[model samples]
Target chain A: MKGLAELGEFGLIDHIRARFPQPVAPELGIGDDAALLSPSAGRQVVVSTDLLAEGVHFDPGFGPARLLGRKSLAVNLSDLASMGAIPRWFFLSLAIPAGFSLETIEGFLDGLAEQAAEHNCILAGGDTCGSKGGLTISVTIMGEQRPELILKRSGAQPGDDVWVSGSLGDSALGLKLLMEGVRLGGAHDPLLLRQLDPTPRCELGLKLAEAGLVNAMIDISDGLLADLGHICEQSVCGAEILLGQLPLSPALYTCSSKQPVFPWPLVISGGEDYELCFTAPRCNREAIQKISKTAGIPLTVVGKVTNSRQVQAILPDGTNFQPSASGYTHF
Target chain B: MKGLAELGEFGLIDHIRARFPQPVAPELGIGDDAALLSPSAGRQVVVSTDLLAEGVHFDPGFGPARLLGRKSLAVNLSDLASMGAIPRWFFLSLAIPAGFSLETIEGFLDGLAEQAAEHNCILAGGDTCGSKGGLTISVTIMGEQRPELILKRSGAQPGDDVWVSGSLGDSALGLKLLMEGVRLGGAHDPLLLRQLDPTPRCELGLKLAEAGLVNAMIDISDGLLADLGHICEQSVCGAEILLGQLPLSPALYTCSSKQPVFPWPLVISGGEDYELCFTAPRCNREAIQKISKTAGIPLTVVGKVTNSRQVQAILPDGTNFQPSASGYTHF
Candidate 1:
C-alpha cells in the first residue's frame, strides 16, 4: 500500500469521500470553503469537541487504527447522547505523522463510517494535515434536539433518583489488563472489547428525552462518580451512591475476585465506560423500567440527589466510603 | 501565576471561561456536556475546521502566542467569508505539551476573545488535552447565510470576470523575510503584520453576496492562482489571469527587487494570503466597484473565466506562462 505522504491533502480527502459517501448528500460536503448544513427546523443544535493524542489517549501497541477511529467518534457521540440529542453531523481534524500508511487511514475511515452509519451522522467537513509528532484526532459533533427535550446537568432535583445504564468498570478493568499484560489466556476477551469499542447510548438517551423522564443526564466518560459530581455541581445538589447497586458485568466481578486490589475504585472512578448516568423523578421508576426492557439495556438505581452539596458513597454493608482520587485527569 | 500543570483540566477551563466570557449566552455554553445553539429561521449553517500545528503551520519564532491565536481564528473566519456567511460560533481543541505555561494560554485566550468580540462570534465549546508532542490547535467555526446569498465555487459562468480583494503576496513575502532572518530592522514590518495577523475580507464578501454581484467566491489561503483554480474546477470552466493586472503591495515589490528571483510565482502560488478571490458577471463590474468604494478595500480585476478547462497565466507582454507548481502541498 502507498504511504500517507503519497496521498497528499486533497487526495486523502477524495479518498475519504469515496470511502464514506452519505446516504443523503448534505447541501455541500468535502469541497468548497465550508460545508452547508440545513439543520432541522425549530430544533436546537448541540455541539461537542474532543481531542485525542496518540500516547495520551491511545497507544499504537493497544489496537489497530480501525478501533481507534471507532472509539474517537464514539467518545464524541457519548457527549451528544448525554445531552439527549440526535447525532447528525461531525467535523474531523486529523494530524498524522509521516510514514503512516494509506491503508491505515482507510482502516480508520472504515471504522468512523461504521459508527456514523449506525447513528445516522454525516461527515460534514474537516481538515487533514501533516504532524511533526504523533497522530492527533480532533472531532466536533453537531446534534439536534427540541429545546424542551434537551437535557442539561442543572435540572436534577433533590428528590430525583440517580440511575445508570448498562454496566460500569468493564472498560477500566480492560485497560488494566492490557497494561499489565494479563490477557485472560486468550484474545477477544469481553472486557478488552469493552475497552476498545464502546457503544454510545444514543438511542436510549433519545428515548428518555422523548418520554420526558430524565431530569439531568451525562455520559460516564470520566467514571460514574466524577461525571455524577459534575451534575451535582451544576444542579447545586449532592448525591449518595450505593456501592453494591452499581451494575457490574459478570466478567468484571470474576476478574476482580482474582485481583488483589478491590476493583471498587475502578468501578467508581475509572473512566471510558461511555454509559449513560442520569437522574429522574422517583415517580418515573415504572416508566424507566419499561424503557429498560424495550431498550434491551439494564437500568439500575444507584443513588439519589440530596439538598446538600457533598457527594458520598455507601458501602454494601452500610459503611461510608470515599475515594482518594476522582476520575481521569488528562494532565 | 500558576502553571498549566497546577491548574489541571477543569481549572484551566474555568480560567478560560473567566477570561473569555460570551457576549450573549447561547442556549447552552461552557461547563455543559455540549453547547446548544438556535439557528435563525431559513438560514443554512456553514461549518469549517482548520488544524494548525507548531512547526508545521507556525513557529514560536514567528510571533507571540497572541498573534498566533488571532491568526488561528482568522483562517477559519476566512473560510466563512468565502461562503458569504456571518460568523457566529467557534470550537477550539487544544493539545498542549506538559510544562506549558498558563501565561501563554491566557495570552492566547485574550487574542481569541478580541477577535471573537469583533466578529460577534462566541466561544461556544471546545476540548483541552495534554499532548506528548508539539502543540496543536484545531478550530471549528460555524456560521449562517441566507440560502440565496450563499456564494459557492460552482456558480462562475464562462464570461465571468475574476477579481481579487486587496493586494497579494504580502503574507508570502513576510514568511520569506522571517525565514531569511531579515527582521526589517526590528518591529512592525507591514509584510510581517500581514503574515501574522491577516484580516479576513468578511465585510467585502458579505457586500458582494448581498448585492448579488459575485457568482463564485473563495479565500486566497492557498494563494491566488491555486484558489482560482479551485473555482474553475468546481465551475467546470477555465481561467486566464493577466500578470500586469495582479495587485502587488509596495513592500512586496521592493523586497522582490532586492532578491534575484521574480516574485510572480510567490504572488501566484505562495499560500496564506487570506484575501478573497471571486468571479462575477461583467455587467456587475460597476456595482462591484461601488461596493469596493464603500467597503474601503481595493478590488482588482485580474482574470476571466473561459469555456476551456485549463487555468493559464499570462505575462505583461501577453504570452502564456505555466508554473512549475500550483500551490502548497500538505504532505
Candidate 2:
C-alpha cells in the first residue's frame, strides 16, 4: 500500500514471487511480457472471475496474502470445476493499502504463485496500483472442457444420483472458531487447517468430465443446501435428500463431544469447502466408483434428483425437513 | 460513497451495465454465468495488469468510473500496443467503497463499456467486491500478435526515426484545465475530453505492426520523457528530440490567451495521451506516410535514436530543455 515507489515495482514482483515455485506448465509463470499456454484440443474455454475485499472476505491478520491468493484462485477454479474443466491460466489484479509494505506485497504474490503452481496454472499477467483503501484481490481463471462433455447446472434430471466429494463443514467450523477466538493447536486444529488450506476437487472434476459420469455439477463453496439448490433451480426440478445419508465428517461429529448433534448447519450452511457436488445418471455409477478407487477418494451418494420443483430432506426420524435458507448472500 | 447494501450486488451490476450496450465481442460481456472470448491466432497472448488505488491513481470526483474503466483498459491496451499486439479481452476487478451507491458504479461501468465496445473487445470476466475503505480498480487485458512480429521495448537502434502518433499533451491539458476550472470550447473541448477518453491508437498500432514500420513502441500514458526513459533504459540507447516537431493543438496555443506560448509541458511532461510513440527506420518515411494516410491518422517524425543513453531535447529557440521530475508516478 505504500506508494509503489517505496518498494520499487520490480523488487515487489520478485518478493511476491519468492513464495511460489515456477508453475508446472511448460512455459512462463510470473515474470514475462506475456504468458504461453497449451490448451486442450477441441475444448471451449471456460473463464470466471471473483474478487475478495479485505474486511468482507477475511480477517487481515489471519488471511495473509498467501491464503488470499490461494482462496482467490481456488474459488475461481471451483467454478471451472463445476463445468468439468481443466484450469490452465490465471490473471491477478490486486489493490494494496497505502500503508502496506513491499514485504507484504511479496507475501501476496508468493501465495498466488504457490497456488497457481499447485494447479498447473500459469500466472500470465496482472496489475499493481496504490489504493487509498484496503487490500483487494481479483482473480480471473481460464479453463478448457470438451465441448459436449461439459456439465451444466441445468443437467440434473429425475433419478439422477446426487453425490458429493470429500469432507465438508470443516471450513465453516474453522471460520467459526476463528470468529470465536479459538486458539490454534486446540481440539479443533484439523478444522482450522481445513479452513486455511481448503483443497478443490480439480482432479475428480476432470475425471468425472472425461468419463462422462456427471450430469449436473457445482462446487460446495457456498454450503451444501445452497449449492445444491442451484442445481435444482437451474434444472427446474426438486430434490430429496436423506439426512442420515449426508456425508458428515469426524471433526463435525467430535465438535458435539459425543452428544447427538443435528449437524444441519455444518452440512447445509458450511461454505468455502471447495469440494465438488454433482449429480450423475444411474448408468455412470460404475464409472463413478472406478474414479473413487483410482483417485483414492471417497465418492458419497447424498441423494437423488426429482421431477417436482421442491427440495425435501428426510431426517433420521423419517420426518421431512426443508432448508431454512439457500446460500450466502455477498451483498 | 454509499454503503453497498443500498443497491445490492445484482443491482450494482445492472446499474453499471445500463450505460452502454453489451460489449462488442459476443459470448461474454456482463450478466452471465461467465464471460467468453476467442484469442487471436498464432500468438502467445500478451497480457499486463495495473492496479489503481483511490488516492494513488485518482480522486473519485476528478475522474468517473467510465473514464476509469477506459483508462484501466487503455493502460493495459497501451501495454499491448507497445508489443505490437491487438487486444481482444479484458478482466476487471473492482473494489467499491462502502459508502457508494449502485449509480456510482454505473458511471464507471459506462465508461468501460463504451471504450471496450469501440475497440471490439469483450469484458471476459472479473470480480467485484465491497471495500472497507475507498475505491480500487485492477484491470488485466489479453491480446494477440503474430509470434515473430511482436515488438519489444528493447529494439530501438541508432539511426531509427523516432515517431509518435497524434498530438501530445491534450489529455494532460484537459486534466489540468478541468481540475483548475479553466474551460475552453471547440478543439479545446476535445482536448479536455481527451483527458477522460484518450484514444489508444490501437488501429494505427496494428497497421504499423503488420507493416513492420517501427523498431520499438510504447504508448504515452506516462509522460513522453518518463516513458521514453523506459524505452531508452530497455534498449540501452539515447534519443534526440526537437520541440518544434511536437504536435500541439490550437487549443493548447490558445491556453496562453491568444498568444504564442511554449507548451512543452503539455508536449513532453504531459501524459495519458494514449498515442503510439515508436522508433522506425528512416527509410520507412514513405511507409509511415502510407500508414498515416491509410489509418486516417497523422504519423510524424519527432526525433532520432541516439548513440548514448541520455535523453536530449532541443527547444524551439535552440536551447537545451531538461525534463522535470513530475510525471505519472504510481507509487
Q: Report the lDDT tens digits of candidate 1 across residue range B1-331.
A: 8878788999988888887665355478888889999889999999999999887898877777898889889999999999999998999889998988787888788788888888888888899999998999999999999989999999999989999989998998898888877564464389998988899888888888899888999999888888998999999999999988998998788778877867788899887999999999999989899999999999999989999998899999889877888887778
Model 2 lDDT, residue B227, Cα = 70
Each prediction's whole-model lDDT (CA): 0.89, 0.73
State the lDDT at A132 in candidate 1. Answer: 90
Question: Model 1: DockQ against the native?
Answer: 0.86
Tens digits of lDDT, candidate 2, A1-331: 5545666555566655555455554444565444544455455667777877777777767655567666777788788777778887877777766567666666666666677878887666565555566777777788777667777777898999999888777888888888888756678878876776677778888888888778888888778777777789878888888778877678877884565756577667768888888898988888798899999878889889999887777888999876665555555
Number of the predicted model whose DockQ against the real structure is largest: 1
Candidate with top TM-score is: 1
Q: What DockQ does every candidate get?
A: 0.86, 0.49
TM-score of chain B of each: 0.97, 0.87
In the range B1-331, model 2's lDDT, one tens digit per residue, is 5556766665566655565455454344564435545454455556667777776766666655667667767777777776777787777777776567666666677778877888776666666767787777777777777666777667899989888888888888788777786454444677777876667777888888888777888787777776776778778999988988988777676774554656677678778787888898989999799989988898889899999888788998899897665365445
Over A134-205, each residue of candidate 1 has an lDDT whose tens digit, in order, gives: 999999999999999999999999989999999999999899888887553365388987888899999999
For candidate 1, the iRMS in Å is: 0.8
Any idea what lDDT model 1 has? 0.89
Top candidate by lDDT? 1
